[model samples]
Target chain A: MARVEVPELPPDPTAATKVAELEVPPEIVAQTLGEYLRAWAARVRAGDSGVLPVIAGLAVITVVFQAISPHHVFLSALNLVNLLQQSAVFMVLAMAEGFVLLLGEIDLSVGYVAAVGGVIGVQLVQPATTRWPWWAAVVAALLACALIGAAQGTLITRLKLPSFVVTLAGFLIFNGVVLILLLLGPFSGYPSLLGDDTNRQVLYHLMWGTIDPLAGWIGMIVIVAGLGLALWLRDTRRRRSGLVAPPLGLTLLKIVLMAIVGLTVVAICNINRANIGTVAGVPWVIPIVLAVLGAWTVLLQRTSFGRYVYAIGGNPEAARRAGIKLASIRTWAFVICSFTAGIGGLLYASYLGGMSNNVNGGQLVLYAVAAAVIGGTSLFGGRGKVMHGALGGLVIGGIYNGMYLLGLDVQWQFIVTGLVLLSAVTIDALSRRGATTGSVAHV
Target chain B: MSDANVARAGAQPNAAAPPAGEARLQVRALGKHFGAVQALSDVDLDLPAGQVTALCGDNGAGKTVLTKCIAGIFQADQGQILWEGKPVHIRSPRDAAHLGIETVYQDLALADNLDIVQNMFLARERLRGGLLDEDAMERDAAETLASLRVTTVRSIRQPVGSLSGGQRQSVAVAKAVMWNSKLVLLDEPTAALGVVQTKMVLDLVRRLRDRGLAVMVISHNLNDVFEVADRIAVLYLGRMVIQDAASAFDRQRVVQYMTSGGTNGSG
Candidate 1:
């Protein structure tokens, strides 16, 4: 059955295609920001639409909450400020969740650990007990949380244990730890811990502290200007280096968007929504959240460690092939996650003014995941940002504030949140499908 | 090992290896077993510089097992891997990479969320002041793609997830070549690609050979083997049955050798 003549019918289209010039247009090489934006929007439509749905969902929910309630102040200054304050802890937790979520993993223990950290923190500053300084107390709690995360991550990475099972165990363990510590750890006396003004003051300061109006104004301007400058500088550098930079117009547009949102937030917080005289100015929690957001964003976007996290998430085999230490990156991801959760715990203690045995840590963890997913972090990983969690947390906070103002039951809030989470997950699946099929469709 | 060691070691290609393009990687008497099963046995192969050595076999003919062994995903139970001319132990993928060996898997082994440049420079990213040097990376990636004649991409900044199958395949190969890898192992690079995409990849393979890099392509398709490969090594039941220039065997003969493990099939 040997062929008499060697086959030649394929005719080497390969050679012809190889020799043909690509004819890359000059304009594409020198694309303006406007064209860059158009291309970006097209990419988004093809299914990489980051943060669009969250913003839309927030707007629609605000209007719906306003209409559903008889109160005319769903978007009121006082309510908006309350929403920001409420969002702070959840925002940080959601950002923490984003880390593992991007790695295609989940950390269920964050909520309880936050509570444990908060409890541990308060116990350290128990006035006559451990009597540690507030900063020291905060540092101890964060360290404890990081250690917990490291343990969980180690089991998951080195032991090859499933993250869900490990974190589920963690959820139970930490929740029990909080209860156990409360029963025996420092500041055990309920009244002595809660009754002490300084103990309450230091713990709640993050949640309850406020800055003067002038300070708020200056902070907003500085933050907005700083963000704008950073973005501008980055884009300018890319452009100068002759790489693909976003249009200056797009950069300015984003800065403008940030400015408007920032100014509105400052303005609302400055409004006196108090019953007696004037209770105004931005809360200290706002800046704390921003600082965390900025730091995490840079770590993820600008650093090699952050890039490896995403790489490991996207394709562990590929990352391993390229010489990345999968276990180390994964372990650190969980460590950072738990560490951030520790912050949330302190803020939570501050919000509630005290810790109790039945701290609803489970519900809080669920909300953190919801905030990240709703903000546009995919549950599948490799596609998210800290900012998504922040935005998602605000949306959750908005829904809660609006519904509470309307005198809605906690049961109603749960149903609404569950529905929103379901919607977000559905969107993520659909868009991911779109991404794979979208390219194939063109082919 | 030091750079001096690799350069000195790589200078000595096995004396009895292929009498063609400089032999960069030589595997001798390689054997691998999984439980009671002989996945690969006594497989001898040579990857010469400036040539495409296509590893051809039917399914379960130990093609992938042999590939994994060479890539150091699995250490051979019995055999020696010679890098350049020196006998070297490759216990892991890192060891293989250190020897300038890179494998582009069937999956393309790419991160979808990462852009073309990011995917290309994943673990080996250029850094300035302890941060990712995006400009340097993007520029280097663009230059690599350009040199490889992969001009179909709209932007190097676009995520690899958005790339076409052929484009993705080229990027994966380019990633392997970018690190100055002396040898690249491509596992069925054209398996899921269309005709045009396959052509694109085959051309890239030839371009890589032209650049004097040792390349081994594993493929079931005879047409693809003929299209790009300079030499075709056929495996049958965990053994190297035939090793000859691509022109030495036709489709029917190659198929017969792959199916029946007989020498008489060749013209």
Candidate 2:
């Protein structure tokens, strides 16, 4: 083949060298601990605050509660443990909403979906009824919730309906479903876990039981060590491959923070809390919440499915063009969301010792969304962690517990939570504006 | 009629005689219509490896339509597309990708919240044990950008939203060319870019041709077309009015063909 003789134009002299002269911002190329800190400061200034605001808010709430509560009961070991136990349901529910929220969608039906799940699990394990194994009952309940999520997801994705509207409809329908399920129960309108059957006791123990103090200490150590090792290995491997990795100091700092948190939780739980009998050990609910957090964090940060969720939330058009099955991923997100909500429902039922029609599903759903937002998860999507749910739930739980200790009414709790939710959303919006305007230096 | 014939006669020598093994893609009598509105009709285009072809046209002249047809976003209503001298069907974007054809759309189709490495390896992420292999992906993304001489980005870990307009365009182009693509179609790669950024993108276009990949650029900027294009094809309305060596036509003549569909106003 003869080469075509095309007329050659003289190369533009400036074009060949201009790009190489472009300077990369220093913070972006930070390699030391000091530089990393500076970069973090810059990011926070620009509105990518990460978890700083949430942590600071939590600290303020704790301090205020400690100062204002009568006899300073807020900081007592008994109260702290009680707070965590109460927060468990909220934390799980927030996490359930987090999955869909990260995709810029919402599942308002999760509250009642969780209640339905609890009702199913409690009814199944009733000795006079089917008397199913606790594990089997839990699985069946979660599966039922998953199916509910899938049905809602299908309507939203396949019909191209707005998630807000579809989930709102689900919320109403599931509320009725929960009511009907409870009414159909053998116990009539309420299914209590107050039976002597071993299976029933197991279901009841999920929220009310505690591990031995020694076992709690050992479990804490094992978890901390395992997580720290994983973090170290991953960062070291990346650095060895000449890729971008956090500095060693930063990594060490993170590990230390994790250890400190683990030690504090175990120590507090190890203290005697009961007024009469010996009843001090880490609550089973603590590990359950932690496990959920860990699983979700991995799904969102280390898996392709998680990546696609973020991508879809950030830019659905881009995700579609990238060949992502947007409908399928979205449907799966709803399924996961409802399934998680089912777990939360089970805990709620166990905490109350029964499933009742009086379970305010509306208030619970609102709290779930509020907790997620307050914990630093953006309602606008593409930016959240499961840890945010846990932290936010603690904040919500703290306010409720603290307000009650101060002799304040439940109305006061609602007002305070509303204020916090508004502030968090304001922060999210402001930061978004800052990011878009390039007000902060390099991100 | 006489002037149109004369212009066609002049282009015939170059258009009719692409060297045997040099033409990487050949579109013959391609036609497409959306309902009653014909978007493209009887279009012929040749994209040869080791060269850049600038497809120039006005609004509604079907420049994007032709590119999308080849990119497999839209199927042609009639005619044939020959890839490496074989008639092949392109029914979807996936099929086009499998055939080594990639397109960088006008919007860039990038998630702003994701970092450069994530956006570059969006759908085709490398995986290890069912987890995203961030290390391998980062290494490959860095290498691809380096090979393209896209040095303006601060860090591959920085979000694409943090990058300047020029850098985003560079990333988008790098992503398109990363998968060993034989043919790259860039639709208005320099649109909304500053003067310096436009120059940067044009230089990148030249580099792709130098690397022996067939590049088709849909551009309305005549200066940019002349700057980087080796072959110029002008689309008038729904038909390809002219396809010839860049040396055969000057600015005003190419404009005449673009606006009038012929050198004379008769078309």
Candidate 3:
């Protein structure tokens, strides 16, 4: 073998610098607000648009609906409140699907599984039947859903079956289960949460009840203050320790944005929305949804389990080699998905004041998937946030409310949502391609 | 070996080979085979700490099979592996890791979506109050990379997908060494790298040896083998034909052993 004498290249000037200089990029080490914004702009251009596209789409949607809505009622207090209530179910359901979606998997049975939760919760609390406390009923419902998820997850992981096929079978089976459960109920195929009993009223209020205006204001201020302080302290500590952190100005800007969003939500909910009597306060559903969002966000971002989920989704082979238990993690994801779907089901039953056989489980599942996708969650997995689900659900709710105000039929709503979902998926695929080609960077 | 051959081998003398008792890993009479085929037979190797041993072999020479056996990916049919002078059974990768043996596979086994720190601390994440201690992990990862002289990466926070090939390989090596590994098996670490990237990886390999870790590099490139290896082991058709100090053989002699399984023009 002949040896090729390769020419030696000159030493890189940066190689002799300090470790910090060599390891950190200039953008990451940016010290000022101007530098940070420029770095952010560069990232956006590289196709790491993050939630920017969704926010922009939401803004455009809000303006269009406010203009075209009959009597400009889309932004009115009554309609907006109704819209939030309607969106609660979608938001929770989308969040449920997000757990599996982050693992590059999908759950088709969430729709009916959620219905089952509502059935169990309402059935157990019936006056003539078990008469269990509302909390117990809710726990039983969530546990049942978790069991169903675990069964499905086990089949997919242990049996090495495709998740799509397993969940598809679950979808049909659970739908039947929901129907059979409703039939077996003490009520005549309809379990209503409407009753004078304290337990039943408490369950009903989960979605429909409102906090006092003054209490709502207090809660908003306290929450915003706590969150803002946490963010500020964490960033400052990291920066002081000479670690990678966002600029101080960026942290302040994020806090300001959070405050503004909180103020707007509370201010809107404080307005009177009733036709006959004064009905004013933040709906109980808003805080419930926000609590779920906050908990899930922390779970997915700050825990090793969450890191493993992303790792498995991105590359299962890599995750396996890393000593992560693929079966356990995948199973847990399904369980969480089903459990959260149960929460959504409870909200749905509460919103309608009853669990009827006429609940369109099929349509609800599709909308859940749609909401997650439109909220900027990637279908291919390893990318997304729980906050995306809430935002996307709001988009769906807005379209539904606007179409209703425009006197459009349900079919038009379906068509528009389908188109929007397609656009979102297209963006996801394109950005993924861009990332692979080195034209884009993932944050 | 003649004087001319010794001169051609390079300036390093055969004294670079450590005494046999200093071997951090010892493989004796190792034999492995499938139901109908013998992948390896009667293999003997000693990987001393603080040295790089380049395992040079042709494509069907059982280089990978031997490496896998040592990595505990495949159990040897017959053999005793002595870890620091005590025989041990390595039934799985976990067992090998427990004994401070880590393998950097050819594919690297790194998640693309994860950043450098995350990938390095994949399953072994440090947690405080049940939450990932990102600060501690980052500081440690950064220090490890710096110690390895891996200065190519822009930031430890950037995702592995955005890293160049050489940088990714460096991260993999760093991950392996960070586990206090006594022996690191690198399979074709520079196979897909260009000239510069290859040099970067080779430099990292040398640094591992300098840090008192036993490094086994499997490569077909004799140029790299001669450049970095203190010792050379040539495998041919599931048989170990030659194992000696790098200064004992020139490139032609090593290639002759690799192709013919003998230096005397005999199979």
Candidate 4:
């Protein structure tokens, strides 16, 4: 039999044949990403969830308070710098709380855990016995806190227990541990090594150290350049994937804001703040906090673990059916919460020059939780961001500082915090109810 | 292109006659119990391809239980559900989805918070990058609705809660269609619809049949049953009393069989 000549393969069989031979009508083209985004925004505006409104209201209130303040120091450069420094520790702790809250869970042990972590770290560099370097001590402190968190996480997840009960237990146990550690002093079997004052100096130097002007400038440049590269890479990937991305103008605006904030902080710290004419720069802890926030934000927003945390928080049964290891995500969430709290604890101790037995747990846990909630994170779970912790913590810290500047008692600060937390939760609950009831337009 | 012509053309493409020998979905002596209560017992039913089979019964007739069992919401205490003649056990909603069986419960189980595209892609979402691929998902959702000729919805972006009863039913039906389900079990889809809306939903049932997907409709409304169903199965007190071709029994006999615990020769 004569072999039939095979037809040459079409360059693109599906498209070419559909156009030339199949007589199929052309498919309707989907909207461009930009066009679709504009439409989506219009829709959001018409029946928007009120997250932006809430955020805007908060900003307006803050600005108005600053404008009306008797002492114009509320908007002064020095005060702003002070505000950033004060917010640093609280931001870390609040963010740690945010991580657990996103999974519809709570961790009450962070306060004491942080205290314990700080105490342990400081004790590590005892000149009388252990001659560990500052970095080593810091690492040891973090490790201790992480272990505490992991232990609590394991108990809650493995036992299928409520986080409220488990973390409550953790709070008591860790608090006792802290007292024990502090009472025992540094864990040295023998004394007579490096002098005590040298150990004290090392601890002080590590916590409050400043870099040279050139080093500071160099560090800022590296950070900005690295951030620029990352943003550019992300934008490129999004575009290549045929996805929607923020407008270039919007991105540029964001970068400019970031630079202004960064440069202003650096410049203020670089100014001579020394009564004895000492060269001043940002506390190294500032950069450390920023780095931690950036890393944790990426972990929470970009990874599968983060997605599962949100999913479980939103609907546990849905997550279970999706084959997500709920227990593992929750455990890790608790672990991060404790770990970050530990960091905050160490920073607080460093800033205070030493950890004390008088460190309050009951009040600290409330502040941390309130900071996260006030930052616009949903207490109900499945809806929160790391940035919320930073923003919320700043707000709470600002209230404390503002009231102190205005000569208000500590009681008023507590009252303001309580009201803010209450308002945030009430707003969250109302919006959720509105969405469920199909009254989103009202929202 | 005229409405009359389209209706005439669609009227008989799917012949009123049942398939000669092929059973699309077969439930063989299915049984289920809740502690002491026998929710279902020895329930046998056959759903044929290109036909709207009505599973009709009163308030406590084990209709919901049987549908749930087939949809894998609840495991049958004893029995085999043969899908395309293969013995299978449906242990979960996901399993039922894999087996091309979709169930629209009484609540419709649609997340009111989510818009049409989101609700349609709930549990099963499209992803282009790392996040929810909104563009791709909306396009696919639009296409799916368009193929079903679901024009009741003014916009897919609108929340399901804003839709009329008929439109919501259409969405639930569309969601099932998106899963490429071979058999869709609808629980009282037209329970709350007005006359015109009910007609719209009935027409949708007919369209589903024309598309060659077996449909098992659970309804209390006999008029809806007589209007759209090709075969009707009646249950009373957790037992299947009669299952017959819709032409075999009129409304009177079907109601009698539904209420009394007696078999009718028409079945």
Candidate 5:
């Protein structure tokens, strides 16, 4: 029973004699608080720092745009709130896109699928014919979107067709259905810029409605504090169970950051920024977006389904050998992607006051992919967080909003976004190449 | 050492075989065919508990076919697979796993993006309160690796992609044998390893055997076979060439049987 010198290993052993003095390379286990920080810093240097690059890029973009703008409106409470609202749809869409991206697959049809969902939602709640509650309509539309996703997933998984090709066809077909649906009714729910009375009531409330100020403050505190506690509890449990844990300092830092960001957003939205000066409260969309974001994070991090998603994305062969039902997981993934995209479509309809056949779904899908990629979700898959889309959406929205505040046209916005997207992709490619070539070993 | 010389020397040590007990898995008259091609025919072998049996064969010689059969990656067209001397049906990989059969394929079958414990408890994850019990899994993974004396990795929480080739291989093997698996099959476990890495894997293989598990290692490298194998089984052109204790033979005799199906290195 010779003692094997594994600093990370426990005292338990069977054949420790043969391994004694073998100099088994220590796993990247951090036994102490300082070592954990050092390991994390090393990982960041190794380019495994998930969303840091995207965050840094967003910061740089914000600073530059603020410097060039008239009143540094990038940091203005009103502008920031507007950024959140404007980016909310794209953010949801990007999170949806992250699923397929994580599986090393793509869904080009999500935009139109979303359109179909929105149209169905509006039609189902029509006042005269087949009036359903707003919640019911939302559910029905989501289910319909999921079915479309299942169909596409079946084509891609069972038929073994490339998702690019299948979803590209989906991109055309669903919106074609949207066009036909538009011709069927007068669509009284479509809002008139000059104030139309025929507009359905829920659409008006959902997109523009806000929580009262006191509730907003209370709600923000509860949610923020709750999330922090949940995160902290999870780590504490891991540590208590004698597993590796990040240093307490790191955990506290993360909780503090979450609180700061959450409170800041709440504070900004709580300010009265309307033209007439009476409108002040957090938009209902804010909490909705936050809820979705939170759900996506949980799905990706905690669940067995999430594990399989990463496994499939990382190595399909490995997942297959692990006896995971690759087809089922993949199909479900596509279903989830379209389901979230359906939410994005509803948001888009709400933001614009109606779904149009001419809605730039092609552009919407592109922006979704762009958001995920720019936020540090890998185009190659298996290396992204759902929150990456959240951050990326904010960046994209911030850019557009800041440009609007500077009085720039859509063309400038396009040019700047395209450049940012290009830089992000280049960064991704370079980092991956660096990883394969062992650049991270030194770090 | 000459083929006959190392054969004699290696043969003397483990002739009685299976330090733990009797054969756990026995295959008799196993036959498989892929269309007109006979991948395996009349393959008979015995894998006792607590010993390393090295399966050696030339390309297309049904060595993989046999390993896959035992691992339930493929079902034999004919013949009986007996566990503890009782005939049993092994159909899918899942069935094989249910029977405590774990195979570490040549490619390692690990998600590189995942951390160590995640990779270890991949499909068969331990759960608590309907969620992944991370603490329990981490503790188990650490214990498993330590019990196997696997200490090369700096952190069990680090992604598998960061480890060296040998470390990945070690993790795959540990994952296979950690959960009370009676039989562990490693397909070409050290096929692409360097000298030092190969030695590390061989040591790990011996450690697995000492833990009272039946380990069948597939290797083209005879030196590795000689280093860790307690028993040597050779498959030649989809037929059982020979199955004998390692001390009964050496490098040349095994290669001779592998290529020509000759007995004792003679035509």
Candidate 6:
């Protein structure tokens, strides 16, 4: 189709002539295209590269590749669950980074702090040692991460040092601590906690020991109710506040999608993974992650502290003039980021069935950052959501798992992951620039 | 909240007591030097509330320095600022805000990313239950904008960056008004505006005065000063060369005070 220009009407032209003269001017069409090109360039300059479209494109590619693959098991139930399990840890870690990124800062220490937390978490909850209750162990791990974050934050804020430098120092120091605490060598402790070589049993048993029929129903109902309550509250608030809310049909459609996905996942997991005849429901980590996501969403959006973090991210001077205690907010943001990373660490150790010094800090940190960025959190700050990390992590995990299933090597997986991260960031930059240039719709 | 609150207006010479149609912000022999360069020295200015006080000066004529001194961006090296009848020391922007003195810098300091309501409530957001009370803020913002009759804005939810030059100025003024500012110091409010927008802004300035708030406008536009100001204080080099009512100074004399240091035809 050729481009057409909407012609300007004469002050008192006849309606017929006006209609007749409505032909596209080549110059006008060229100008419109020029404007669009300029707008795209401007958007790129402004750093909003339209990451959503890029994510959508990646999803499309994934679906197409899976469809063309000879292996039918690639899209099967067990594989999907495995993919989710792989994503769980990274998703949480990405969330931790997302919080700090929203403050226009990065916590380079998160990876190692997470590694340290994993060591301590496993040690505390290791079935043989049983030094503490599982809940207490989890709490201790989280608090340890929080305190570590607070220490780093204090150094950065009070001393007014660049977070990059401070967190880099933290990364080095924490990594060392993790290695020393874990004893560095193989065979330092008891044999694998989940009884050697069976991937999901230990974590699955620990989180949801007995996932009978009743447990599955209970979990499904809880998830549906939670999603429903969230949607209802949001709509009601929007209505009360007289803001333009999504249509009722759209809202209901979203809730229905959530319910379907939740019910389907639970049903699939109940299909007897055990060859000896018993099966289980979804893992407890699913609900735990959901709960954490909800809590953080509220904290980052509903509270003054959350808004202040965004304000500080968007414009620090403006925040200061508003009398916001910058140091306190910055400190708290890091604390929350680290605390969440601790949860991620625990989940990772549980998944691995043991803590090891061989944990790849470099690769893990990149994946976490990639997950957050791909999910649509801006690296520049003040623009992201918890859901981004969760979604982005799933996408990254999918790529890794899919590549492995297709018999690709680790090198290829790394290459694909890097490409995805770059593309996502580019799109984000483009979209933001488009919005600032006033060429994008619904900025 | 400092020692400058000692010398009030009534305690100073040539300082008329606050009465109907008379408003004043009296500054004593204020001095400020940026290292060796004396930006301002023994500068005295009286800006009465309910009257448009035009602070006119050539480039580097200490007009901006003096304005900054009064607005608390810089602590005057020597002297005090008297609002109403109290001597006050302005140490920071917060201090000036507490005294109900607002300064609209040339940059406007409005965040482009934020919408009208957000920008209007920037640095002073209304909160309920420890969260930003969006509904309450929106309502107040709407009311404030409506009272000012700023109809150019198609939607308050639109980002301020999307606004025309004049609309942005309107938002900035509304922000000041929301703070319940007593004396608003406008630093070249209409500098970049078109004719129609400039008229709209001038009208808003008049409305500010009508609402009993004192306004100090700094402008190089003689047409604007003549159109809005009740008095003009022209600064040449580092000294205030002429202080006259708007009724007393013509365009020619005002320009003379602005360019050369003296007015030959008058005064």
TM-score of each: 0.89, 0.92, 0.93, 0.76, 0.90, 0.82
Please, what are the lDDT tens digits per residue for candidate 2 over residues B1-267? 324433543454322233555489999999999999999988988999867889999999998889889988899999999999999999888899999998998764788778889999998989999999988898899888877777655578877766667778889999999999999999999998878778878877877876778999999999888887888899998898888778777999889898888865321
* Tens digit of per-residue lDDT, candidate 3, span A75-112: 88888889999999999999999989988899999999
Give the candidates in order of DockQ, highest first: 5, 3, 1, 2, 6, 4
Candidate 6 per-residue lDDT over residues B7-91, each given as its tens digit: 3322432222334433457887888898999888777778777667889988999888888888777898887778786788888
Output candidate 1 Cα RMSD.
Answer: 7.1
Runs off by more than 4 Å, candidate 5: A1-49, A70-72, A188-199, A437-443, B1-13, B18-22, B263-267
lDDT of 3 by residue, B170-211 (tens): 999999999999999999998888787889899788778777
For each candidate, the alpha-carbon lDDT, in order, equals 0.81, 0.84, 0.85, 0.72, 0.80, 0.72
lDDT over C-alpha atoms for residue A313 of model 5 = 87
Model 4: CA > 4 A from native: A1-72, A123-162, A187-287, A315-332, A433-443, B1-15, B106-180, B190-211, B221-230, B247-254, B261-267
Tell me the native contact fraction for each prediction. 0.44, 0.40, 0.39, 0.02, 0.51, 0.13
Write the number of the candidate with greater DockQ, choosing between 1 and 4.
1
Tens-digit per-residue lDDT, A77-123, candidate 1 = 77777788888878988999999998999998889989988888877
TM-score of chain A of 3: 0.92
- Candidate 2: where is the Cα deviation over 4 Å? A1-28, A437-443, B1-22, B264-267
The lowest-lDDT stretch of 10 consecutive residues in candidate 1 chain B is B1-10
Deviation of model 1 at A435, angstroms: 2.5
Model 4 agreement with the true structure over A132-248: per-residue lDDT tens digits:
776788788888888888888898889877889988998899889887777654433222112346655655644466778678888987888778777767656644654434445
> Per-residue alpha-carbon lDDT of model 4 for B174-235, expressed as tens digits?
88889788999998988877776678777778878777789999999999898889888999
Give the alpha carbon lDDT tens digit for every residue of A1-443 in model 6.
12122122112224422221222111211224355445444444444443445367557746965776567566666676677778888888999999888887888888888887877776765555544665677778889999999998888888988888898898899889887867633448422445532232444344434356578778788879887988878766865665534445556666887888788878777666665767566766777777788888888776677777776766676566655788989999989988998888877777777777777766777888889988888777767888888888888888877878878898998999999889877866765554422311121
lDDT of 5: 0.80
* Candidate 4 collision pairs: none
CAPRI rating of model 1: acceptable
- The TM-score, computed over Cα atoms with residue i paired to residue i, of candidate 1 is 0.89
Report residue A212 deviation for candidate 5 (angstroms). Answer: 0.7
